[model samples]
Target chain A: MSRINDVGGMEGFGAVPVDNAEQPAFAADWEARVFALNSALLRRGVYNLDEFRDAVERMPPAEYLDASYYERWFAAITTLLDERGVLPRADLDG
Target chain B: MSADHGDGALAARVRRAETLLEERGVVDGAELDAILDRYLATGSPANGARVVARAWTDAGFRDRLLADANAAVTELGFRAGGLQPTLLRAVANTAEVHNVVVCTLCSCYPIALLGPSPSWYKSEAYRSRVVRDPRSVLAEFGLTLPDTVRVEVWDASAETRYLVVPRRPDGTDHLDDDKLAALVTRNGLIGTAAV
Candidate 1:
């Protein structure tokens, strides 16, 4: 099945924003933390890059579209951890 | 449904996940901090620009970069992928051809070289339209190519990434390495604009 992340040729999105000033590497502290966490997890063998990508791709279409870039990475990291039994879904809620 | 960086719930969830991983011995906060520091120190557009500058000055390096990007980049102390070995392909922009890179499925870019991708690069409008109507998309970025210049859009995958080797601008014969590298921009390396 074609996933929402597979948005190659499909259109309807508005104009791409072009800003001359370079954007900071991370928008916020949380975003940076998410990036670091994802990298650390991947390096530690908690999950491979493809597996994390699959988790991101498996997100619901609306959810995937709604989430920001690092938010999606956070979602995939949580999903992989939950699936791997490293962190149960309930634990995150609690 | 859009989750912004200010979303408290999302931030809380990320923190919770980090704690859980630490408790489970999967990863620690110190290690994660170290990784972030490493990226902050080395990841930048300057790295990619330096590679482009060297390629422009040294024809041998240019040939090696086009032939085997991964190994060639290593010679300059730059690695393509993070945490995994990703094949890097250098697509050169010539007088007759313009090359652009995109990951339709996800934002699979050479982050180590180009720093973080620009927000527009990961936008739905770019990922979906660039492959279909590159000229129109390039026009949106204010890069209007001639009709005779064939555009090639490269779709990056999980195991592979692409970097655009922009053509050297004229009248830069006397510039040193640093000066030439300074002339290259992030957009130029991404093929969204000329250097």
Candidate 2:
């Protein structure tokens, strides 16, 4: 429930697992697109970095941990745009 | 306000938002795609390896890199823009100390330098464990440091990013920059391993 993003030195997390296999940066085209879109919008001043980060951090702990890396980005972008009233929910639905 | 929607649904929403931005003239679709292609291409750890290799060979440049990382990297013609420019710090590992970078908050990484952050680096386990038990985390990465070496964890934030300058491996003095760069791995730059 805490909005704090700094989790360094916290306890109760499990053992760390390492995946050393080499892989492409993005798993698919959509990931690349999302990556570009997020940076593009950020550069264009659609939203500041902290606000976008806040949107990501505001996620419920369970959801944050369960979601994939880009999933979190998508969630943040959606929430930020919604909060800004730039992209309405109806547009997202339809 | 989160959905369990699969990647398909998430991709659809991402596309919709992308189209919305284009339609509003905030960003051009073609330009964004082209930029994205270039961005992804530039994300390999090789870029970081090159920086580390240069640092290992040139002490003067290493000092400059440690003092002013962004400027030093720009001197080598590597710069990142778009998504607010933040301060980047380069922490060098010596015989006595080792450093590891993590974003306990949310994978705040130097994507511009090391390319995309690895999936494991973003996992909650890594964020949660690296800070608490860095030695074990390093061991998991196949890097077993001696007890004499101190482990320092750098937590990345919204305003600052960190890059680890791994110690040059033994018997590498004869190798050229390209060869040394070839030896540098992404994990090495992340302090999970040594170059």
Candidate 3:
């Protein structure tokens, strides 16, 4: 089954946005935090890189599309933690 | 739901996850800060540019880079892999060929060299079209290649990341490594534009 993330060669998504303006490494503080959290979790062996990628790919299509790049990373980190029993699933709900 | 609405909810969830992890003694705030700092310090487009500059000046280094990019990059004290080990392949752009790198599945770029990928690189339009119709996609990026110049689009779907060594522009023979490196941009290293 091809996931939404496997979006190579399927068209209809218009022109790529090419704003040459200076783009920051992280758009927001939350984004940096999310990136750091993901890195830390992976380094700690909480979940492997493949598992984290699979969690991102397993997200509901709508949620995955609606979330920003770092938001997707944030979602994957939460999902992995819940699945690994590091944090209860209810913790993500609230 | 739009990304704007999702951002608020996701931010709260991230904060909750961080707090939970900290409380459980799984991850520390300082450790996370250090990870971010390490990337911030080492990850830059300049690193990739320096590699390209070395290739432009030293033919031996260029041959080594094209033959084994992972080992070649290590000579400059740069880590090609982050978190986990990944293979790095250097594809040189010659007079006959032009190369571009893309991650069709996800944004799997060489972050240690080129910093984080630009927003357009991760967009659906680029990932889906670049692989199938590179000429048109390169045109969108304002890079119009000649018909004779064959375009090669490398899909970084797996662990191997690709770095494009753009051809050195003419009249740069007298320039030092720093000056030559300054001419190389992240887009040039990605083969989206000429240096």
Which candidate leads in TM-score?
Answer: 3
* lDDT score for residue B177 of model 2: 96
- The models' CA-based lDDT, in order, is 0.88, 0.82, 0.88
Q: Which residue pairs in candidate 3 have backbone atoms (N, alpha carbon, C) closer than 3 angstroms, thus clashing? A: none
Which residue runs does candidate 2 get wrong by more than 4 Å?
B1-3, B20-26, B80-82
DockQ of every candidate: 0.75, 0.60, 0.74
lDDT of 1 at A48: 88
Q: Candidate 3's residue-wise lDDT over A13-60, tens digit each?
A: 888888666698888878999889888888889998999999989999
How well does candidate 1 score on lDDT at residue A52? 89
| Cα misplacement distance, residue B115 of candidate 1 (Å) | 1.2
Order the candidates by DockQ, highest first — what do you get?
Answer: 1, 3, 2
lDDT of 2 by residue, B1-195 (tens): 235666677777788888887887878788787887787777668888889999999989999999999899987788743366889899999999999999888877888788888878877678888988899888888889999999999988778888899989899889999999999999988999976
Model 1 chain A lDDT-worst window of ten:
A13-22
In order, the candidates keep a fraction of the true contacts of 0.78, 0.67, 0.77
Estimate the lDDT of model 1: 0.88
Give each model a TM-score. Answer: 0.95, 0.90, 0.96
